[model samples]
Target: MNRPAARLLTFQLPLAAFLVFLLFPFYWMLVTALKPNRDLYNLTVNPLWTWTPTLDHVRRLLWDTHFLPWMRNTLVISVGATALSLAASLLAAYAIGRLRFRGSGVLGITIFLTYLVPPVILFIPLSRIVSALGLWDRPAALVLTYPTFLVPFCVWLLLGYFRTLPRELEDCARVDGASRFQVMRYVTFPLALPGILSCLIFAFTLSWNEYLYALVFLSSTDQKTVPVGLATELVTGDVFQWGPLMAGALLGSVPVAVAYSFFVEHYVAALTGALKE
Candidate 1:
């Protein structure tokens, strides 16, 4: 074969394999969600492509359970946590990245190091704090606890983005009688839109998918987030409700997928630390 043809085959083969590996779980979930219980268990039929498709699982998931309430609870917690983390991270990033204070380097490293601390270690202490605040078994517990991990990563990410921006811009604004707060509001934030959106996506996705904290803090079935709700409610000791479980998994992922699709450009820009003007 020609060298160009061989090179094309080499790259395309790996690319196709990677795509299949990444997407096969989603395909499995879709098929499992649509398969009837009998078909789901039947050894005679192929499990990958069900001949008898049914919406019974989806119907039962919606009508018989508190799926909608779980969705609402997740939405509220994720949004609240994201907003709180972003606001705090934005201010903290500006101070660390631009303020040029003594020990600022150590402070920045310290903040990033907090993000590296495993959640498993933090959750025990956080659970006690949540209970002490009378937020046990409440969505408020998650909204507050999520930011403990989220804020550090966001502050670190936004600090990098802020560093790429020129400090002279803020100086120019301050020269025109703009207060520090006003400069941040009108100048820094507008330029950091990509980083802000990236942080929002990260924080929201983290909070939405969080299971350990939700499982520990929230006891009521109605207050559970989708991840915790699906895992706890869909399994009865040894018996797993595979159909409804897959259905919940499929539906639970749609919102985050749509969000990433919409803001993917900005997300990429943030990761690359690139900004226009």
Candidate 2:
């Protein structure tokens, strides 16, 4: 084979296959959501494509179910968790990365190690904490608990990014009679915007899709997040509402997709900066 043809076979073919593999789920979800029950259940009909597409599932998900409320609860919880995690992580990362303090290196390592602890294990103790605090079945429960996992990862990422930044700029700000808070506000924080945005997106996505904690913490229909709401309400023992379930899943993923589409460049840049140190 010619060199160009070999390159196409080795690179383009694999790339195309991977793209299809990655995208096939979304395509399947869309098709399943649009398919009528008759076409959906009929083994004789093509499963990949539907002759009759209907909006009944979407309509049912929006009108018959509490999907809109679930979405609102999810949005509130995700935003709250992301904001709280980002604020705490920024302070923790900056102090560990920039300040000369005793055991700062150990502290940073310890924080990152916490991220490795399985969330499934923490959820059990967290359930007790949430109930003790009277936050169970409330969005506040998730907002507070989500930081257990989110803060550690965010701090680690921010610490690396902070290390990559030139410390001289911070020193220069301090020499100009600026306070620590002022230096952070005007100098370090501004430079660290990309990393912050990356952490925000990550935290939001995790909070949005979180299932175990959401399932355990929230029992009310109106208080549930998208993931929990869809799973519990759309499936009844042996029966699965496949159409509405797929519709919910497709809709639930849209916010995260839009978030990545908007800030993907910054996310990549942040990861690059963090990896530099």
Candidate 3:
């Protein structure tokens, strides 16, 4: 083979291998979720295609656990946290990115830095605050705690995206006798929809998948989001229920995967972040 052809093969081989390696586990989980207990324990290799696929695990996941309630709780906390963070971060990022103020740079840095704060340090204190505020042992604890991370991360992410947009768009709106809020509502926002969507998806997924604070704060069975609730089930006994657990995990990840793919599909439709102003 020619040297260039050989180099191409070397690179392509590794890339293909890496992709297969990453995808194989997801394939296995789907396979496992579809397989009967007997086929699963039958001691087989290449279980993906070898097993007699069944929907029993999926059935049990929906019927056996409080799966719907957990999903609802997750949706509640995720949507609430995302909406709250989106509103607050939009205003804050706009101020920091488009408006001039003394100490704005320092405040922006501080907001970004808040994302790096470990939940371990803050959860305990926040739990106390939640108790004082009468939010303990409820899904509200998650809503409250999630903003600690979501607000900062969204603010930072949107700050960069907002900074890249042309100021002339808002300028034109003002010349048309639009108020600040009107410019944001009618012009600036239309231009920044992509960043807003991205932040919404990011913050929602983060809050949805959050386990630490939810596990620490929420005590009610009906109030626990899917992540913490599923984890609690994973440790009910010495032997883990790997089948149902994987089944639940499979279902749990679907929304997030759909959201990511949806965002990627329409990534170019918005005028922020990935857009070149």
Error of 3 at 266 (Å): 6.1
Candidate order by TM-score, decreasing, is 2, 1, 3
Best by lDDT: 2
Count of clashes in candidate 3: 1
Q: Considering summed lDDT, which 10 consecutive residues are worst modelled in model 2?
A: 268-277
Clashing pairs in 1: none
Q: Between candidates 2 and 3, which one is better according to lDDT?
A: 2
Clashing pairs in model 2, backbone N/Cα/C closer than 3 A: none
Residues 1-277 of candidate 3: C-alpha lDDT, one tens digit per residue: 9988898799978898999999988888787778777767766555566436767778877888887899998998899888888889999998988887888989998988887888888877887898999988877777767888889888887887887789988998899999999998888778888778888878877887888888888887777888888889655887766678788889999988888788875443432443332
Predicted structure 2: lDDT: 0.92
Return whichever of 1 and 2 wins on lDDT. Answer: 2
Q: What is the lDDT of candidate 1?
A: 0.88
Can you give the TM-score per candidate against the true fold?
Answer: 0.93, 0.95, 0.90
Model 3 whole-model lDDT (C-alpha atoms): 0.81
Ranking by lDDT: 2, 1, 3
Steric overlap count per candidate: 0, 0, 1
